[model samples]
Target: MLICQLSDLHIRPAGQRYQGVADSNRMLGDAVRHVQALDVRPDLVVLTGDLVDHGHPDEYAYARELLAALTIPYLVMPGNHDDRDRLRAAFADHAYLPATGPLHYCIDTYPVRLVALDSTVPGQHHGALDAAGLSWLKATLAQDTVKPTIVMLHHPPFVSGIPYMDAYRFLDAAPLAEVVGAFRNIEAVLCGHVHRPMFRRWAGTVVCACPSTTTEIALRLAPDAKPASFMGPPACMLHRWDPAEGLVSHISYIGDFEGPYDFY
Candidate 1:
């Protein structure tokens, strides 16, 4: 099945410009349009995290509007900037998010089983998996299922090697690693918080981070760095999976940037 992955929408409050830059909410709108324009409707849409510019109700309201434009059933969780209560209130009807408890849930639809976990620590920028969260994850993985499974979260369990971004990554991930590492059925660990695309192995499984659909974190091969002036080609990821093909990922860059757009 095809799963279109969108992350770091970073939607701000209506009319609130982000530091004299383009409307992040509008850029998110563009991403929705692009997804709608896809030839094959993705079986599902997985929104990784950072759905709002801030944890404000107004920002969530704006995000709620923009996210509703997609026709596909989508799932979401919180990030450092997200307020869980506000997210739950805004999308009360969403299945995976669950109106209460763990801020985690699983979806099983014939060929695929997807798990979305809440990695955001309340009032913090970095991430961690608490005892309760770890217990639930271990139990969930214990279930016998032949369908290919994927676990999605907001923080990358592996270091992105970008010094500044790495500082805010998942802090207590071993409990998380033990659960995922023991699960032979799991295919990949899907995440998005770094605002950059990445693929690497963590605890015997693959960990991937989807790039933002709004402003991207500047390619910081340098230390003590920050995201650049916010004007960059926005992007997202598409993950194609099959029992035969396993898992493959693609990075889609959207917007005007220095490119040939030409034929050889």
Candidate 2:
């Protein structure tokens, strides 16, 4: 199965720009078009959150319209910037979304079971999964030990070298890691709050954090690296799972690029 992971769209109201410069909506539209034009389209697309800038009704409405260009099916979870009620109401037609509580659930239609967890803490920039959320995750993973499972959420359970983002990393990650570590069938933990493409080996699984379809977080490594963002190439992560290969992830930059011409 091939799954495309897109994150941190940060869509704003139509004709508006995020941070006064980045055209998030246009970038997302380009991303959608790029995904649609892929030689081999993904079977499913998992949007790991920050779908809008303000989580306003207008933003969500415009975001929905932009994403509607996608011919392939997609699923979305919320991020710190999103408002739960507005997000759920925006995607209400999607049956996978739970009617109440956190926007957490499972997608079992494909060969791999996507277990989406809500890690956003209301009214906060940081992330956490409460006891009830962790319990739900544990129970869900225990449901089918033999099935290949991927845990999807908005926050990275582990800290990235980027100090600014690390401060806002998932606060209760230990408990979530504990549950994931105990599960053998867990293939990977996919997430996207960092706004950059990153991967780490954790909890006996690969934790893959996807890049944004809008601007990217600057790759600063020093202890006091300034907090900032840059308009690097927009991109998404493509995850392909096979029985023999397990799971392999590749970064796919949006828009056109130099040709894949044959080597002379």
Best by TM-score: 2
Question: Candidate 1: RMSD over Cα atoms?
Answer: 2.2
Q: Cα lDDT for residue 57, model 1?
A: 86
Clashes of 2: 0
Query: Model 1, poorest ten-residue lDDT window?
Result: 224-233
lDDT of 2: 0.92
What RMSD does each model have against the real structure? 2.2, 1.0
Q: Which stretches of candidate 1 lie over 4 Å from their true place?
A: 226-230, 256-264
Candidate 2: tens digits of C-alpha lDDT, residues 1-264: 899999999999999999889999999989898888878889999999899988899999999999988989999999999998889999999988999989999988899999999888889999999889889999899889999999999999887889999999997688888999999998899999998988899999899999999889998989999999999689999999999889989999997778889995
Off by over 4 Å in 2: none
lDDT of 2 at 61: 96
Relative to the true structure, candidate 1 reaches a TM of 0.92
